[model samples]
Target: MNTRTRAAIIGGIITSLVIAVFAISLNSNIFRQSNTQQNSIQNNVGITSKLKVVASFFPLYEFARNVGGGKAEVYSFLPIGNEPHSWEPSIQEIEQLKGTQLFIYNGAGMESYISKFMSSGEFSNMTFVKVTKGITLLKADAAEDDKEILAQGGMDPHVWNDPILAEQEVTNIKNAMKNVDPTNAQYYEDNANAYITKLNTLDNDIKTGLSHCKKDTFVSFHNAFNYFSNRYGVHDVWITGIAPEADVPPQDIQRVIQIAKDKDVKVIFSEDLVDPRLANTLADEVGAQVLVLSPLEGINQTEQQEEKTYLDKWYQNLHNLRMALECQ
Candidate 1:
């Protein structure tokens, strides 16, 4: 028990305490860094794991959204309030397509620019799904004067207007999704089946609702309802051709007016996004009321914000048609 030995023992004990504190602080810092890195990696994976789907327009966007459910992120190539009949994607938008896994469009010449895009071979990795693949297209019913405006022998591209064809489109979308992401095949299948069931109900409702109507012929702003009319055994007397923006000829206007009078049409149909002045004039001439008949090409920003869906719009259209046709 000498004084020098006692001092040496105390100093050694203090040195051991300092080393232990340093080691604990170092390990704590290392653990926090590791956790932060792991969280960041997890966040990145969560984002990239979701399938990126690009749809040509609103209906396809909705169908893809329903089919994708939580497994995919769907984007509409056409902006809100824009008509799909003449919408062409910008360079920036085209470039954005490179990042997506699938592109869904209603092909039957619906998208005029799609052929160019497909032939360009720019999207080699992306799978292009034409929802109208199995559905037969009807001849474009353009007015005699506007025949030159629409391409010769053009097929109607509004197949989504018919619930039965919409079911087919949904099935095509589901197939495309499954082909690209087989890991979530069952998930996509379930979601698609649920939507298809809703479509089946819609089909039945439309058939039953229109069966007892007083009139079978209706005046629409454009020839966007051939598939719908053909399905339900009704007829559409459209003012314009396949393109809604086509100018209505004076002769055609007089012709439609005569037909309206002969058929005793109570209502003239206009589109949500089109200029309604012409429809109003026709209505005034025929002593009929004007109502909206949306083609569902693209909804406005307000409708998008309200989360309006395809079925909602179709039901609204049906209600209006029933009112116009004096359906029982």
Candidate 2:
């Protein structure tokens, strides 16, 4: 080959390589700038990014979401259908709390492990909300008739069962959100007010529905209805004790049957999430029908897919209770 042709070819190849390197460098800079801008927006424009909120259970999840009004990304620590009463958080779940804007949980001893989480002294930036505050707590009677043996901390954490108290819980959640993400204060408050109104309506409906019942006594599988019974003037006779044991004693079963027979109960109620086999045996023995009563705890995924609200579940409870008690 001629020297002039060989020199031209070498220069052209070097130029092409230089051009490719420059193009790559420009592309990398653009990519880096795009990432920096995204990170800056996430950091500086907090409201533009959804607030990270964590709820201990389903009821809290619903309340938080309703109050946030699609502005917050609310996640429930417990999955759908999990029984919150006995749930304990895993290490990974605890790690998630570190980045959340708010962590809302029903107090009143509902989440027994929360104290330990607080003691960890980590996640100092996260705002922890106890929705059960500013409300009266009910005592858990250790057993149906015997009050001598008080339960774990002896506080009934099922205050959400009472709509009046539930209103307060919803309020606490709203206020917490407003505090964390102050720009949306009015939005959260408005949503909270609307939800509280619905809860009020539910309370009235339940009162009116159960007012003229033929009997006020209804049987339950567990004693998680102190506030509901007290608020509505209904008598709840729970088959199992406040804390159900693995093997429910024969006497306890006999007592429930006797109560059903004495009160002329047509139906015996069991918790939806719990095993109803024991209640089934008692119902069979007493010749009574069995109904599943929700304590308004965490709902299953199926119920969520059906879009069942707390009010809907409560209404169903009232309907079943009226039928069981022969309400007029």
- List TM-scores for all candidates, in order: 0.83, 0.82
Q: List model 1 lDDT by residue over 1-328, tens digit each.
A: 9999999999999999999999999898974665464345334432457888999999999999999999898989998899977777899887667557788988766777887888886665567899988777787766333333244346777899999999999999999988777778899999999999999999999999998988888998888998898899988898887889887778989999999999999999999888999999999999999999998888998999999999999999999989878899
Clashing pairs for predicted structure model 2, backbone only: none
Q: Highest lDDT among the candidates is held by which one?
A: 1
What is the C-alpha lDDT profile of model 2 across 1-328, one tens digit per residue?
Answer: 9999999999999999999999999898974665455455335424567878888887788788899877888888987777876678888877656557688988756676877777876655567899988887777775333222233346677788899989999999998877767787898999999999999998999888988878888898777799999999898998766654335678877788888888878888887788888888888988999898888777887898998877788889888888987878
Off by over 4 Å in 1: 1-48, 143-153
**Distance from true position, residue 327, model 2, in Å?**
1.4
Number of the top-ranking candidate, with TM-score as the measure: 1
How much is the lDDT of residue 205 in candidate 1?
A: 96
